[model samples]
Every structure is written in structure tokens, then in C-alpha cells.
Target: MKSILFRFLLLYFALQVIPLDIHYYADVFSLPGSHLGYRGLFVLAHYTPRFFGSTPSFADWLVVAALALIGSFVWQRRQPQPDWDRWRYWVTAIVRYRLAIGLLAYGFIKLYPLQAPFPSLSNLNTPYGDFTRWKLFGMSLGIVPSYESFLGGVEIVAALLLLYRKTASIGALVIVFFTGNVFMSNLAYEGGEYVYSAYLVSLALFVLSYDAYRLFSLLVLRQPTAPNTWRLALSRPYLRWGAKAAVILVFVILYGVSAQRGYRHDPYQVPGGKGIVTGFYNVSLFRIGRDTLPYSAMDSIRWTNVVFERWPTISIAANRAAHIDASNTEAITAVSNLDKTYESQGTNGRSYYDYSFDTASHVLRLTNKDPRLGYDTLTLRYDRPDSTRIVLSGLSPSHDSLYVVLDRVDKKYLLEEAAHSGRNNHQLKL
Candidate 1:
């Protein structure tokens, strides 16, 4: 237990818990961007010979590795292997507590269907080839929200189990099996959670080692095994109560409240609507420059159809070549829900825009959601002649004079209908 390897492992965990997730923490407390200034901290992190990259995980890992290497060397000369039973006990307590916190956060997000939200109209209408494997995985999960919730339930159960010493082994086992699968899935799908997921798996494996021999003797050899009855006791009353209070406050109150608010207000995944009425609209007329192009299949430049989402997004299906943001890397807490240009992400079939409307002025402002080109804006005058008809006319971003009219269509999607009315219900129509 006092081996160099054990000390090194402990040091790694210590380093990992240093709270380097600046962006996540900033977003969590709704702190101003300047508060967690990357520019200011750049020097300290750079001394990890560091990188203040977009994702702070890599930077944190680098810093920890550097510190661990130095720490191990210093400890090697000083203690030469000191009695560390007390340290181990406390470390184990910290690991289990931290593990519980991580699982709960992830579990709640999935439980509320916020991690992989229901498919947006834009996503359903998009070409299959357009989505990266990771995006496809998320959309596939989104299709079966019940299954997503089931996965979350499993995580939550594991978290609850970890809170009790008797059940900590079982909890660790669950985490290993579950997070192991998660790690593999992330690798297979090119998902962004690989590092963090693997990090949890490592912690779980360490916790499982406590009961590994007992389990092996009992289950594998069919031998009588004695359970570990040694209980952890705190020497100081304040320390014991303080630790418990801190865990509840940070893990329960802070993370729980944040996740709940996110589920209701600004979930990571797209919710039912944004800011516009969602529907498929037929492009009744198209005018560009002095040429009024008829609705001809061969006219690639003319839009065939348009889709307006309840969100602040619109999609136009045209043969015109569109730039797509195909990178599979994921960024979290970078923008608000209203500003999430989701329709344009991992989509190739149509041109999408994040739009805002001034109802009083009868004007619509649109910004093309192509991250590659920087958002391009278009200001147009709009009129709703009736409940089903919408007309828009103005100069396009290209400086070309244009006009377009849209007719609303009654469209039903199988997935959503299945959700509104239970799939097993006989009376429900597809």
C-alpha cells in the first residue's frame, strides 16, 4: 500500500481534482467571462509548458502529469514509504464522493433528455451522409428517449450505491461496466467524452480493487470469504461534519440545481422549440435580380422548400452549394441555447440561418449559420397574408435583390407522433 506506484496513482487523482475546468465552472455559476480569464491564466498553464486550448481537459491533464512527476520524486526521498493507512482511507472517501458527483451530473442530464435531445425538424430532414458518427449516435439516442432515461437511471443507482460503504463495491462495479461501455462507444463514434469517461473508469477500477480479492475468492473459487468490516472514522468532529456538508452542498445543491435549470431553460440538446413556429413551407415563388425563376426541378439556384423551426432557426433546401461545419469535436458552454446554430451543425442538405424578427416593423433579420464563412446577415421585410402564407422580400447577403413566398404544409413525423401518443397504444396512427 505504501509503494511508489500507489503514491503516484494518488498524486494523479490529486492533480485531477485541482478544478481546472474553467469554462464549465464559469458557466455553472453564470460568472462573467472575464472572471475566468484564459488570457490571464495562460502563463500559469503555459508553465505546464501548457496549452490553454479550447477544451481545458487536455491542459489539466498536462499540468497534473508534470506535478505528479515532481511530487513522486520529492516523496521518494522524504517518506521512503511512510505509514499511509489514514491517507488511503481519506483518499478512498474522496474518490467515492467525487465519483458520485460525476455520475449524478451525467445521470441527471440524461434522465431529463437534455444530453441527447429529441431530433429537431432540421435534423430529421437532413441527409444521412451529412452527420458525423457522433452526431448520428446522439440522434439515434434522441429517437428513443426512454432508453436514454434507462441509462441515466443506471448511473443514478450507481451513484446512490457509492454513498454507502457496504455498497461501494457494487457501485464501483457498475461504474466500471457502464463507463467502460461509454468509453468504448465514445471511441467508436468519435465522441468528445472519451477522456472524462475513461477518467471515471480509472477511479471505479481503483475502488473495485478494495473488494477484488474478496470477490475473487467468493465468486471464482467458491470459498468462504470474510467481508471487510473496518469502518472509516474521523478524528475531528468538525472535519467529519464539514466534509459531509461540503459534498451535499457542492454535489447535491449546486450540480443538481444547475442541471435542473438547464433541463428546463438551456439544456445542451435542442428542446421542442426555439423562437419560431416549426413547419415545412413550399417555396411558392422565387425572384433573383431581374429574373423570376419558375419552380423548375432543374433550377438549382431556386429553393424548393423551406423549414422554420420553433427555435430561432430556418432552413432552405436549395441546390446551391452550402458550406457545412463537419468537424466532430464538441464544445460545451460556449454559447447560449438561443445562439446554438444547431441546424447548421453536421448538416449538409440545406442552408440554415439563425434568425430574429421585429414583429412591429414587419421585418425579419437572418444570419446564415455557416461557421466556416462567419455568420452572414440578411435583412428582409416580411408579411403574413394569412395563417398559412408568408411573404419575404429584400436584398440577400450577396447584395442581390430577391423575393420569396412560402406556403405552410401539414406534415406529420412518425417519431414525434409516437412520442405524443404512446407507440404501444392501438388507437394511435403512425
Candidate 2:
């Protein structure tokens, strides 16, 4: 029974380390020099095998368990080892490092506040009911960045503790609590990370099992517990510290620096480049082919509000139904500005567009960001008559000539207002 358990775990963790996706290797071979930014971080974070589908699924685990069971049988038949203690120790080390690196990859992103970015202007104005459960969960964390950073700090500390053999149990204990909460939250919020979180929790449990009896005896039974003294001696200095240092260099230092640079320069979730004008504007006048439509809450065809983000993105609020993009996973890296879907994902209240402002021609070419909504594009020419007012004339997606007037809204968010008024020191006005 002991040998069977060890063999099964060895096979399971080996499968966990090896990337089974063909595309993962393709990405590895197509590396463009040493410029591994967020792209590299993603390659590390999403290391688990996905033989069944693109996203992590429980079906894959079930298959893996079956395979491990069969392999243990084969392993026992082919070669029966006299001692399994040394082999178990080494396999546990592999799992410990894998969990440590995985946690670090996610921790750095959160540490720098890039994982759940601050809500955009459009997100702020969206109705509460318009957002999906996963979006709401992320937004709640995004709003309190300090809290998010604290969580990241905890994860980082745990990962660091995991590198040393003596402190691995402590790190595993921390992860059992922290990542267990994450797993439950994902299940409750309809998030896409429940599978991945459970994977981490499993690894933590395996590591914790080594010292579980000692802890039980010390804490529960109120008895003297002997410390774990088994240590594998590496005679060479390179064998002892070199491997550990390399792991730290790659996982912590390199990944952390890259995450910081990404946050400072180009946030992966946010579209790149600046917009011509950025503000919230009220759709004062709406005209479609010489027919003027009065503002009505029930009018699906008429635009109510338009928001120009700092990036090359625009969001329009109307009564029209929008197809929600339900992808809640990490936006590791976007190939183009149009491919960045973090802002539009899990929201159905407004239409988001990736727009290019041709300042030379005074034209705006807008394409729907949500692929589920189909490829709808609009070409409009703008005229800013004054500082507060603008007029747009062009063809709509339906090939109808359209004329619209926009009035800049001097809207202030309470969160921003409180920040400016020093919420910690001064009483908030509202």
C-alpha cells in the first residue's frame, strides 16, 4: 500500500509538471530573444496539462488518476523497490518547487496590482446587475488594491518558505488556508479558477502530509514531538545551493521584474495607445437618416451615454442587449489592442469597441471588441465645436447615415473624490 501510494503520487506530479499542450511547446520554440515579459509569465503560470480542453477541467484530473493507478501497478510488477522513503522524499521536493514557482507567478502579478486592475470609467458607470458574478468578484478586489497587494505579499512569503526543505510544511499550511479560500470563492462566484486552485491545494496537502503526524502529536495530543531530521546530503556546492538559487532567480527575481515592468509600462488588460479625447459624454442629440429620436429609457436603438477610455477603446450605453464575454481567466498577453478583452469580459450592459482615431482625416473607425457580438464596425467623422460639445456624422453599422451630438459630462466618482479629499485624514463630503 505504501509503495502504491508513492508511485501514484510520483506519476501524478510528473504529469502536472510536464506541459501536454502542443501550443505550449510552439510558444517555447518561437521565443523572440530574451524579451520574455508578461508572455513569459503566462507560459509559466499556465503550466498544467490540458489534454481534455483549453481551460483546466476536472475530467483531466480523473484521467490522470486512472493513468497513475495503472502505472503504479506496472511499476510494482516491473521493479519492486526495497525502499521507497528516499524516492518519496525526492518526488515531494519536485512538487514543492512546482507549487512554489506557480504561486510566485501569480503572486507577482497581484503584488504589482496587475492581476485585477482598477475598474475603467465604463465599468464604474455600469449598473450592478449588468455585470456577471465573476466580474463582480474581480471588481470587488480591484477596488481595494491595498488589500490585493497584501494578499500577494502573503503568497510570496509562502512561496519563499516552500523553497527550503525545513519550512516547506509551514508554507504548505499557509497555502492550504489561502488557496482553499480561493477555491471556495471561485466555486461560489462562478469563476474559472476553481480547478487550478484545487490543483494547488492538492499539492499543498501532499507536502503537508510529510509532517502531518508530528503536527498532530504536538498540537492536538499535547505531547512532545520529535523534529524531522532526515536530510539528503549533496557533497558538491553546485549540487546543494546552485539548483535552489537558479529556481529563485528564474521564478522570483526574473518573473517579479517582468511583472513590475508590465505594470509600469503596458498593462496587459488595458488597450495600448491613447485616445483622441477621454471623458464621459451624454448623447444629447441622436439622429438616424434625418429622423430625430428623443431620449427614452426604453429605446434600444438610441444611444444614452458614450465613454472614451484613455486607451483606444470606447463604450456606449444603450438599451440594446449585448452578448457578454464570459472569459474570466488571466489576460496574460494580448497580441493586439483589439484582442484585449479584459475590459469587455463578463459585462452585458454596454457595447465596447476598439477604435482607431485618424486625427489627420478626423475619422474614428470602431470595431466591436466582443467577438461573440459579430464583427460590427462603424466609421464616424467627428467635429468638436466647443470644449464641452461635439458632433459626429457618419454611417452606422446598418449603412444608415447618422448624426449625433455629445455633451461632456463633469461626473466625479465618489471613490476618486474620497481619495482626493484624503479619506484617512479628512471627513468625506459625500
Candidate 3:
């Protein structure tokens, strides 16, 4: 039983450390994608809850717990051999050296300035955005304040400690604590996706347990070195070859699977096509009913049905309609005698608002705003090409009815239009 357990432990390590398509198991377990090699397993463990739910699936926990129990039982059943030298060498090289290297590599990767492409680092506030608006966080630690640099520093320090065997135990403990924090954070806020931090934690825990055992046996037992002269087998050429082969095989498998799935070469590109805009534009007009009340009191009157409009020619009409909506309340009112104005501006002979219709979605968005409204976003949508018209549900505060038809060819043109439209250069007053 002892021999079988020892062999099983060795085989488990070989399987885990060897680069293979063992990641297929992660897919079965519903793990997220990872860039790092076997470290992906730990990432999967951290992120499992995102796909599975807040709680781990019973099967996942059961499998891990079972493996741990079996391994523990096997380890305990082994007879105590007084091969002190052999044990020490194995503990130092296999447990300490491997762990130190792994941690250092992980730290280096995190510290690598080229990691700007990562989503977490790119949009730091997005994660917090899930819980609350980013503005509520007070400090920009998670977003713009460079928290990635801070975390990288922590990893570097921990890695350095682990490399020095004397401080390895302490280093391992610190890593565990740090990684544990990351795991908890990922679980709590990351929607259960196994993040890179979780992988670091698992590696730390494994190293910690292995190193602690050796520390206990060496110091507490006061064992003298024995004559077991087995050198560390890690540096053997065959092992290096095997590790390389494993990595290549895993990559091949992953690539093949990805290809079969029809994964995109780049998923970030806008769908349909570039330089195309599409979506609905709802244009709502407010009119006064048979009432002599103020414009504010006209709020009780329901807005008119949204009018569908189009771009370029139709966009000009929509802007004119928006201006009328803002200014014509008195015209519809029975008592108010105030008159309203509407204007528009464009470049050359083109309308200020033009469409770059997206072929895929058949959507058009206004590219330019009327200069009279100053700088503002004006979006419009067309359901179909033949649909002759677009709709406007609302206008941004920058929009004005009086200057909708002014052409601002340059800054000077803009200022002249502003002045002519009865708006002060500093303030856009209707």
C-alpha cells in the first residue's frame, strides 16, 4: 500500500506538471480560458463559481476533496525511512526550487509592462463597475491609480523571499496569505472566473505544505544527515525534453480545439463591420394642447408619437423637427404668443448630420452635430433604407433650435454662427 501510494503521488505530480491536454478536464469542469500553462488549473478553480454559481458544484468539491484525502492517506501509510539526505535534497529541489521559480516567473509576468492588453489592467474600473459606479470607489486604486504595479511589487517581494531557501517557509506563508486574499476577491467580485491571482495562491499553498513538512522533520526531529546520495533528478536532460514535449502537445491540442470552435482571431473588432453605426433613434416632439399654461405646465401633455427619419436629407429634417419641438410649444398653446425658431448648418452643401450606414445591421448614425448646438453627440437610427425617416426621443443640452441650420466651416464660422443665433459665446441660451 505504501509503495502504491508513493508511486501514485509521483504520477500525480508528473501528470500535473507535464504539459498536456489535461486542460480538457478544465473544460469539463467549466473553467475559463487561461494564458499560463498548468497555472490555468488554479485559475479555473477560482473562476468555477462564475459559471457554476456562487457555490461550487458538489462534484467539483468532491473530486478535489477525494484526491486530497487519498493522497494524504497514502502519504501517512509510508514507513518512516531514515534517509535524511535524500529527503532533504528532494525537499529543497522539488519543493523549494520549483516553487521559487514558478513564483518568480509569475511575478515577472505580472510586472511585465507589455500586459497592457489584459482586460483587468486595461479597464480597471470595470470590475468595480459591476458592484457600483466607479466614481463611488473614492480612490482610483482599482483603476487609474496603478494598482497593477502595487500587486506586481508584492509578487516580486514574495518571489525573492522564496528563492532564498532560508526564508522560503516565510515566503511561502506570505504568498499563501496574499494569494488567499486574491482568491477571495476574485470569488466575491469577479463572478467566479478563475483569475491569475487564484493560480498564484494554489501554487503557494502547495509549496508551503511541502516546505513546512521538511522544516518540521529537520528542525523538530533533530535528525542527522543520512548517507542516501540520490542527487536531485530535476536537471536531467530527459526531464527537460519531456517537459518541452508536453508543452508543445498541450498547445497543439488547445489550438486544434479553438479552431474547431470557430473562435475569432480577434473578438474585439466591432461586429458587422468597422466605420458602421446602427441602432434605433427615437424622435419625440412635445406640443401644447388646448391650454394657456406655461411651457413647464405643458409637461402634462403627452409627447407626440415618435417620427421615423433617415440620414443626410432625413437628418436635416429630423434636426429641424427637434428644433421645432423645443420652440413650438407656444404655437400649440392657445394663450402663449411666443414664436419659435429652427436652423441647421453643414459642410459644403452636405447636411450637418450624415450617416455611415453599417451594412450588416442596416443602421445609420449621425456623424456630425449642427454647429449651432456646439459640440454634442447626436445619434440617429434608420430601421430600413426605404423607411425614409428616423426618430428622436430626446436631445442633449448642447442642442439648440435657433442655430440648427448654420454652417460652421471653421472656428471663426462656429463663433459667428453662435453670435448670430442669439447665444452668447460663453453660454448657449435658448
Candidate 4:
């Protein structure tokens, strides 16, 4: 029974260690020797096999588990069982490092509040009902940066503990609880990363099993528990410490530096800097092909509210269908204005556009960020007569002549107000 269980676990986790995703190899080999920095390392650390899809899928797990089961049976039948203690140590070591890398990859992003970025102007003005459950979960975390950081800190701490042999069990315990909660939250919120979270939880549980007997004997039975005395014998001193040191240098130090740089300069989710005009504007006047249209909630063609984000992004609200970019994972490396789709992901009732500003000509060339509406492009000439008013003349998505008058609302958000005045003592004026 022991030999069968060992063989199964060995084969199962070996499948995990292998990069089944074709894109993983593409990313690995495509990096230029000169540009092989911490960014590349960070990307490598976060990799999960995507044979099924980009995100970890249940089908992928089932397939891998089946294959591992088949391979384990073959191995058991073909060869005599090796030293169980020695083999288990090596397997545990591999699992520990793998889990540590995955956790740290996510941990660093959240520690700096990059995973769930602060809501943009459009996000702020958007109706709560317009956001999907997953987006809502992320936005809720994004609003409280400190709490997000705390969660990241927990993951990082657990990951650090996993790096050492002595505290592997403790780290596994932390991950089982912490990542288990995350998995549950994903299910409850209809989040996309439930499979990945469950993957981590499974790894944690495996690691925790090493000390489960001792813990049960000590805590549940109120009996003295013996510490695990078995340790892997190393042929060389360098192999024992040198390999561990290298892993730490790469995953912890290098990845951390890269994450810090990302947080300061290029936040993965939120675009950096403010646009020429950044604010929520109420669409006071709307014209479609010289036809003056009054604002109506049911009118799909009439503009309602327009939001110019801090970046070169615009969101125009209308009674129109939106192609929601419901991406599962947040550990994205691409930071282009178009690629920064978190602002539009899982959002509806508004059309998001990535625009280029021609300061000399006062022309704003807008391209729809949604892949579904990628062909929807508009050229708008803007005139800012005052600080609070912006008038735009352009062709609508329908290729009709359009004109819009935008009146900026100096809306004071409670989140911002609460930052200055204590949340408990803030006065409500809205």
C-alpha cells in the first residue's frame, strides 16, 4: 500500500513539474540572452501547465492524474520499490520548491497592490450591477490596498517557510488554510482561478501530510510527539546549500526586485500616469449625424457618461452591449496600454477605448480596446474651452458624424474622503 501510494504521488507531481503547455517552452526559448532579467525569472516561476487552456483547468488535472495513475501501476509492476524514505524526501523537496515558487510569484504582485489595482475613474463611476462577480471581488480588494498587501504578506510568509526543510510542514499548513480559503472564495465569487488555487491547496496538503501524524498525536491525543529525524543524505556540501541558495537568489531576491520595479513604474493592471484630461464627465449634449438626441436611458446611440482615465483610455457609457474581457489570471506580464485591459475586464454598459493623443493637432485617435470591437475606431478633435468643459467632434462607431459636450463633475468619492477624514467620522454629502 505504501509503495503504491508513493508511486502515485511521485508520478502525479512529476507531471506537474513537466511543462505541458507549449507556450511555456516558447516563452522560455524566446528570451534574448541580454534581456534575461528578473522579469523572465518571475514569468518562469508562475508557470502552470496549460494543456487544456491558458488557465489551470479541471480537465488538465484529471488527465494528468490518470496518466500518473497508469504510470505508477506500470512502475510498481516493472521494478522493485526503492528506499521509501529517501524517495519521499526528494519528492517532498520538489513539491516544496514548486509550491514556494507559485506562491511567491503571486505574493509579490499583491504585496505591491498590483494584482488588483485601484479602481479607475470609469470603474468608480460604473454602476455596481455592471461588474461581474469576479471583477467585483477584485475591485473590493483593490479598494483596500492595505488589506490586499496583508494577504500578500501572508502568502509570502508561507512561501518563505516552505523554502526551508524544517518549517515545510508549517508552510504547508498555512498554504492549505490560506489557499483553501482562496479556492472557496473563487467558487463563491465565480472567479476564474479556482482550479489554480485548488492546485496550490493540493500541494500544501501533501506537504502537511508529512507532519500530520505528529500533529495529530500531540494536539488531538495529548501525547508526546517525536520530531521527524529522517533527513536526505547529500554526497556534496555544495549540493545541499548551494542549490537552495540559488533558488532563493532567483525566486526571492531577483523576483522581488523585479516586482518592486513593476509596482513603481509599470503596474500590471493599471496604466501609469494621467491622460491629458482625466475625470468623469457627464455627457450634457449628444449628437449623432447632426441629429440632436436627448439623453434617454433606453437609447443605445446617445452618450450618457464619459470617463477619461489617468492613462490614454476612454470609457463611454451607453445602453450598448459590451464584450467583457473576463481574463482568469492577474499575474500578467504584458503592460501595454491596450494590454492593460483590467479596467474593462468583467465590466459592462460602457465601451472602453485606448486612444492616442496628438497634442499639436488636438486630435484624439481612439481604438476600441475590446477584441470584439477592435475594428471600432474613432477620430475625435477636442476643444477644452475651460477646466471643466470639453467639446468633442468626431465620427461615431457607426461612421456617422458625431458631437459631444462633456461637463466634468467634481465628484468626491467616499474612498478618497475617508482617506483624509477617518471612516468612522466622515460626513456624507452625496
Candidate 5:
């Protein structure tokens, strides 16, 4: 009876992991854009558009549950349930590899700080109230790359331990506790990985059940417990050790190295500065159609303040009423940074633009970044008087000849200051 039930549970988890996790197979190879690994991720991104609000939405879960039931019903129950010990070794091997693969994929991403990158220059400039709860949580982790690395290290430790017979239970237990928190965090932060995280948690629990009764008696009820998890002899030692060696080589060393390369060159998160300077500037002077305009709160035709991101984005604050996007789901795969839409927070109240600078021509060709609205293109010639001042002259989005002077504000962020300070008897100054 126990064996039959366990078999059904195993099948259920297999379905869950096989369909949802692209990383199961993608992390095994190195990448450029055309590489097999990148292709796999690309395919999954398009095919598996995460459910509107939740991954594996209620309808998805219902489909998988129904399949598990039908599979269980057709398993020939009248033939009598087999002894659990006879197949426990095979069951454990399946769980070990599955957990190892999943954990290693997540571990390497975090290990390199690509999963939650350091907050970009734009994020720093944005108002705190404008950020979504999920963005806030993610940016909080992004600040301390070291902490993210530690989290990755923990997952990798579990993956390594799960590869062995004696330590598999311990690894499963770690996943249960660690991923349980991850699932809960996703819930609290309005994150999108809740279903996948919960699936891992469930798989870990199933694996732990092998030793659950023994652990309960040993620790909880304080009774003697026997270790009866039977195993096959090491007769095919070459085949067994060879397989283990290959897994370590490919998943641990090769995959780790490849992931690090991706992190260095094309990290999967919102970029920090896109090689541009970031700052808040005062629009000290504004002219429309060759006529100088006084700075007024109600003047939409004149710029007042602007924030330049380290990324490819900038925002101009004026008397404009902008539309803000309120969605919180994070996209893991992207064709462009704009697709992820992380920089859109607090943008609705301002005119947000993404720009490409031509250093040779001193030109700024700006395009409206907001999807809800469009504006005429703005083309301007720019000159830096010094590191602290910029001058622009060109055509406005309204097709008027324009001139502006921007003075960089001397600014300091509390978060950056906190990160730089030591946690001793030192006082924190804002």
C-alpha cells in the first residue's frame, strides 16, 4: 500500500518538474545567444507565459492532479502492493537527481548575483512609495550580493549532499525548510515563483517521508528506531561512479563556470548603469521655440527636473500627468530590458524616455519608454560644461526648437551610505 502510494506521489512530482522547469535541461551547457542552452530558455519563455497572476494557476494544478489520479487508478492495484524496501533505492535515486538538478540551477544563478542584481541607478533615483512590493523585496536582496551568494551556497550544499545515499534525507530536509520560506516570501512580496517554489517544497517533503517515521521516533517520541532503507550492492561500481562523476562535472563545475560568464557579460536582471552616468539634475533653464520660459508648476511645455538612469532610461518631471503601471509579476526571460519593465515604477507621473547617446555627434535621440502613451521623438545636441552641468539644444517632442541647461544635484542615498558604513559603534548620518 505504501509503495503504491509513493509511486503515485513520485509521478505527480515528475509531471510538475518536467513541464515547469526549463532550467532542468538548459543549465547543462555554455551559451552565446545561439547556444542550445539559450535556445531552451528562449523556447520556454514564449511557450510558458506564466499564468496571468500566478504560475501554475488553479486550472493548471487541476489538470496535473487529474492526470495523477488517472495514472494511479490504472496501476493494477489487485496484483497486491509490493514491499516498499524493494524499490526504495530506485525511488531515492530519482529524487536525488531531480533535486540536485533543480537546486543546482537556482544555486548557480544566485551564486553569481545575476538573479537579483545590485539596484540600478534608476531604481535608486525613484521614489520609495512608487515601487511595487515585489520590486522592493527584490531590490532589497540586490543590495547585498553577498547575502544572495550565501543563499545560493546553501542550495548548492543541498544539491551536493543529495547526490549521496546517506546524506539525501538531510538535503531533502534542507529544501523543505529553505524553499518553504522562498514560497512564503513570494506570497508576501507578490512574487511570481510561488507555484514552482511550492512544488519543490512538496517534492522535498515526499523524499523526507522515507525517514519520517524513524526521525519521529528518534527525536519526537524518544524511541529506538531501526534503519531499514535497503540498498543494492555496488556490483556495477564503474557505471554508478561514472554517472556520479559526470553529474558533478557537468552540473557543478561546467554549469557554475558558464553561469558566471553569463553574469559577467549579460546578467539576466535589470542592468545597473548601461555604461551611462546617473544623477538627478535641475533644469535651470528651459526654452521652447527660441522663447525662454519661466519655471512654473503649471507649465507642461517647460521641463523642471530630470533624472538620468545608469540604464538606458531617463524621466522628466513637469506639470504632466503620467500613467503608471501597477503590475507586479516579474519576467525571468527577456528580449529587452524594457520588456521586464522594472524602470516603469513612478513613471506615470513623469515623461519617461529611453535614450541612445551618440558620443561622436553629441546627440541624444530619445524615445518614449511608456507603453500606454506615445510622443513625438525628441532629438537634441548635448554638451557637458563640466561633470556637474549639461546643456541641450534641439527639437522638442512637440516639434519646437528647444534649449535647456541641467545642473547636477549633489546627492547622497541613505541605502548607499548604510552599505558603506561598518556596523560597530559608528553613527549613521543621512
Candidate 6:
């Protein structure tokens, strides 16, 4: 019985260790342009579009399905020759210790001092920005006031609870809920399909399952009250110490292996930063900037910046704007309104802008409603007419709109007017 249980555990760990390409399968199977519904598992199983030849890769699907089946088998019915006494005790002890370690690690990660400044949402235009953006249901929930500190506090408390056995269960419960929320949100926002919410959800579920199983065995099954030889050994000081040490060593090795694989598998570390600009999107206050442009850049960008920021106030506006050409109509109209409003309120000087790539022209366009430019298009054509600078161009009826062509390659900004010629238009050459 001990050998069989050990083998089962080995098999389970091996399955986890295997680098199954679930994300690849998800991409291949996903319905193009559709949000993979609310449930993560459901999306994995059924959301693939058949028409586009999108279907789950056989190997990945098989692996996940098989593991789930095996887990169900283990959980559903008791073994005929159930040695609950020995197996239950060992499993419970191992799980408790692992939970402790996991909690401590999580706490440290969250509580670590901010060596780097918090990423500005203006700079970080991605789905992750949605996390910074507060929302309840579909409506805007206001700018997330002090989210980092609040979440950090919760993580600290949860970690503390998990470290002590007396409070560990409660801590696990809290972590389960909190991480679960993050996981769901990640899925909802279509964060990274590979390493985002799904990974956290899996870890949370594992902890929840192990803790719940032990709790059931201890309280309902009343396994602790039952007598056995292993229990007698466990009661001894030397054996107890040995068991704890063994558990710690095993977990340390497992964690090391997992960490190595995680580092190798993850291509993007942290997910937000300015670099070779490819894509940008914003939600609420959070923004996502990706290095790869998606086919739906226009809709995605508009939804992230304008729709999510203003929400219901612009909900009807967004609906009407969706069918229109984003660059020409929707974008122009929205920026015009924003410029008028801001100028009227005497807040014209300072502006917040979200820029994203234009897939058609391969140009980066600024989406700001500044009064100075009258909400005109600001096109950043990289390597245009020169390799050292990005040429900024704009179309306006009056005064030819100001352009600050920043030469990122040379670390200089050449300020000029769009349509004007000669050195006079270079107002503040720097």
C-alpha cells in the first residue's frame, strides 16, 4: 500500500513536471476575436473554433484530460484495501509543510521592497493595466486607489497565517480566495495565456485540494483518533524530526526543479515596459503594452484606452464608434470631445495619452486630446526619411500643428511644425 501510494505521488509530480504546451494548444484551438468565456477550464476544453481549423493539439489535451481523470479517480472512491492510517498521515503532513513553504514564498514575493518604481499606467499599455483599473461587473469602479499596498497587506497576512499551523487553514482559505480572484481576472482580461492566471489558479487549487483532503481525513474520517504503528513512530521525537526534515528536503528539491522550469518557460519577465513598440491597449486605469501586434489592434486599443477609462459615459459612444474607422472617425471624434472638455476645465497643459501601433501603416499613433494640437493625429514614423529619428507628422488646417520629432537613436528631440519648411519651423531644436 505504501509503495502504491508513493508511486501515485511520483506519477502526479511527474505529470506536473512535464512541459505540456497547454498555451500552444489554447492558441491553436481558440476562437479568433472572441473572449474565451469566464471559466478557465471550460475555455481550455471547448472554445476552439472549428471553422478556422483551430483545435486543441492532441498531446496537450490528452495530458491534461488524463491527469484530471486520474485525479478524479483518486478522489472519487476509496481503495478497497485502503490503508488510510499510513497514507493519510504521511499525505497530510507533507501537504501541511508544503503549504507552509508556498505561503512563505508568496508572502516574500509580495512584500519585497519596491526596488523599481511602480510602472506608470501611461507607459504600461497592456491587458495587465486592467489590474490597475478598478471595475465591478462591466462598469468602471474608479481608479484603483492604492491597490499595490492593499494587495501587499493581504498577502502578508495570508503568508503569516500559513506559516503557523494554528492559523494555516484560515490562511490557505484566504490565499485560495485572493489568488482565485486574480486568476479569474487574468483570464477575463486575456492576460498571458501561458503564465498568467492559469498558473496561479493551478497552484491555489492544489493547495486547496490538499488542505481540504487533510481536513476531511482529520475531522470527518477521524483518522487522527485511530491507532497505527506509523502513528506511534510519528509520536516519537526522533521520528518526528526525521519526517519533518525529509518533507522539507523533498519540497526544496521539487521547488528548485519547478523554479528552473518556470524561468526557462517564461519569455516575458514582469510584462510591462517600454521597448520596441508593437502593441498597446488599456483597461480602466491599467494598460497593456505588448511586443507583438494583434490583428485586432484598433478595436483592442480603443477599448482599452477610451472605452474602459470613461466606461458607461462612453459606453454608447463606443457602440456607435466600433463600426466606424478608428483612426479617421471614432478616434477623431473622441479626441475632439476630450480636447474640448479639458480645455474648458483649464487643464489643457498637462495631458495623458495612450499610443498604439497602426497595423496598416506600421506607424505608432498618439491618442491624446491635447488642446495645443486640437486632437489631430500625431504619427510617429520610425526610420522615416532618416534612420536616427522618428519623424512626427500631423494634419491640421491652421498653423500646421507642432511636432516634436524625437531622435531616440541620437537621444535628441527636434521640435518643428508639420507642414512648414526651413529652419524657422524648427522652433526649439534640441
Best by TM-score: 2
RMSD of 6: 16.9
- Clash-forming residue pairs, model 2: none
What is residue 194's positional error in candidate 1, in angstroms? 1.3
Candidates 2 and 3 compared: the better one by lDDT is 2
Query: Model 4: per-residue lDDT, tens digit, 1-430?
Result: 7777779998888787667768788777776665444457766876666776556787887788888899888988888757778877888888899999899988888898888987888888889988989999998999888899999899999999998989999999999989999999999998888888888898898889899999999999989888998877777867868878987898888888888887888776876766888888999999888699998998988989999987888998999876677776655655467767888888888888888888899999988887775547889999999999999998876789989999999999887676556554545543
**For model 3, how does the per-residue alpha-carbon lDDT over 1-430 read when each residue is reduced to its tens digit?**
6654554444344333322343434443553343333233223222222223334443443444455457646655574443545444454434444444445433432343211212221122112322222122212232222455566557657765765545666788988887777557545533232344554455566556655656666779977634323454565759745744443344333422332232122111011123322222222333223322222312423321221122121222121222212111001001111110111210111123333555565454544434355534444332433343332322333333211111211112332354355445336543
Each model's TM-score, in the order given?
0.84, 0.94, 0.38, 0.93, 0.81, 0.35
Model 5, 1-430: lDDT tens digits are 5655666675565565454544433432333455534223323322221323334554666666667667766764644565556455665676677777778878887888877777755567666776778778888888888899999999999989888878878899999999999999989987777776776777688778878888899999999898855777776879878888988887788778867877776565553337256788989999889699998978877887888876777778777766666555444455455554555652344666777788999999877767666534678899998999999998876688889999999888877777777443245432
Clashing pairs in 4: 275-310
Better of 1 and 5 by TM-score: 1
Positional deviation of residue 94's Cα in model 3 after best superposition, in angstroms: 7.5
* Model 6 per-residue lDDT tens digits across residues 113-164: 1211132222222233223221221112112223443564576576556444
User: Which residue ranges in model 6 land beyond 4 Å of their true spot?
Assistant: 1-80, 96-106, 113-117, 121-146, 193-232, 235-430
lDDT scores in order: 0.72, 0.85, 0.37, 0.84, 0.71, 0.37
lDDT, candidate 5, at 151: 100
Q: Which candidate leads in lDDT?
A: 2
Residue 101 in model 4: shift from native, Å? 0.5
By summed lDDT, which 10 consecutive residues of candidate 3 come out lowest? Answer: 328-337
* lDDT at residue 418 of model 5 (Cα atoms): 73
lDDT of 5 at 110: 89
**Given candidate 1, what's the lDDT at residue 90?**
67
User: 5 or 6, which is superior by lDDT?
Assistant: 5
Give model 2's TM-score versus the native structure.
0.94
Rate residue 90 of model 3 by lDDT. Answer: 50
Question: How many angstroms is residue 20 displaced in model 5 relative to the true structure, after the best TM-score fit?
Answer: 8.9
Model 4 scores a C-alpha lDDT of 0.84
